[model samples]
Target: MSEQPHPPKREIFDVPAMTNTDNKGFLRPVDEYRQLPYGLYMSRPADHPRFHHLESWLLPALGLRANIFHFTPDHRSGQRLYLDVGRFTGPDADGRWYSVDWYLDLVDVPGTELELLDVDELFTAHAAGLLTLDEAVEATEIAVRTLRGAAAAGDIQSWLDAQVGGRMPWLDRPVAR
Candidate 1:
């Protein structure tokens, strides 16, 4: 078997001279960063072919980072939300945020399905000694709990709304024409 890859690291710095770095180490200019009660919210332009922009909320309480990809019309994937299970922290003395992906993800299609992804990647990483047993277990638990909560609440949006006390910023944004 091929060796499993290490998890990606993300960082967001508040300094005007600095830019948010993505998993690929690309520095992307952040349009905004809002420190919320539950977590940190970031919006930035994506330098990718599929999506023109990205908005994400790093919810530490949920152990998940939720993303909304502002895809170009021709590249729509029908995915309403993309969630990454991970360890997130931030805004220390310098007001910087950090995230380490745990190799698990959720693809929410809304009213259709909440697909769990990268189970094999999670297991492979654990086997390759890239993640501790405790970390792997925690990541699994977070994914399961999120699925269950979303199911019980009728949808991911409702589940997130309940957790954050209201609608997320992305939810209120006007649809692109």
Candidate 2:
């Protein structure tokens, strides 16, 4: 069997130069695979691991059901604490899915939350071709009026504290199969 070639690493928007305003123009260079619908949301990011674990636990806890997650890139903030947002099935992996929710990383500082962009901007970008119809519809399901929030850090001790019962599940941590 032939080996599968790895996709080339492409540098996207500089990120820091972008602003938080809800402008459709921000959705330029409409590369559907890289920018539209679920494309942007699925990009691999620096904070993906924490978000993955958080999703693993939180989704089931909240009774939300979403096998897929859409973590959109800010591509605007220059700082380490850029705004991160996504959609998922509720806290339970089996529950109804939710979208356009914000995810914050407190980092080393306590009581600090990352700033997030308004959900409408996502839809505006979608309408402008930054996102696909599926992505746009999902954005509509989670409009600006109804936003959600979650927080995490490299260290999960605090994240565990915020859980409904402060319970730690073995599956949340790394395990060998």
Instruction: List TM-score per model, in order.
Output: 0.91, 0.25
How far residue 18's Cα lies from its native spot in candidate 2, in Å, is 36
Listed per candidate, the RMSD to the true structure in angstroms reads 3.1, 15.7
Residue-wise lDDT of candidate 1 within 24-138, one digit each (tens)?
Answer: 7777788877777899888888878999998889999999999999899999989888999999887678778888899899999966869999898899888888889999999
Which portions of model 1 show Cα errors greater than 4 Å? Answer: 1-3, 13-18, 174-177
Tens digits of per-residue lDDT for model 2, 40-149:
21122223433321122223233221212223453322232222334433222322223333221122222444333444555445555656677556544432212233
After superposition, the stretches of candidate 2 with alpha carbons farther than 4 Å from their true spots are 1-84, 89-111, 117-124, 129-163, 168-177
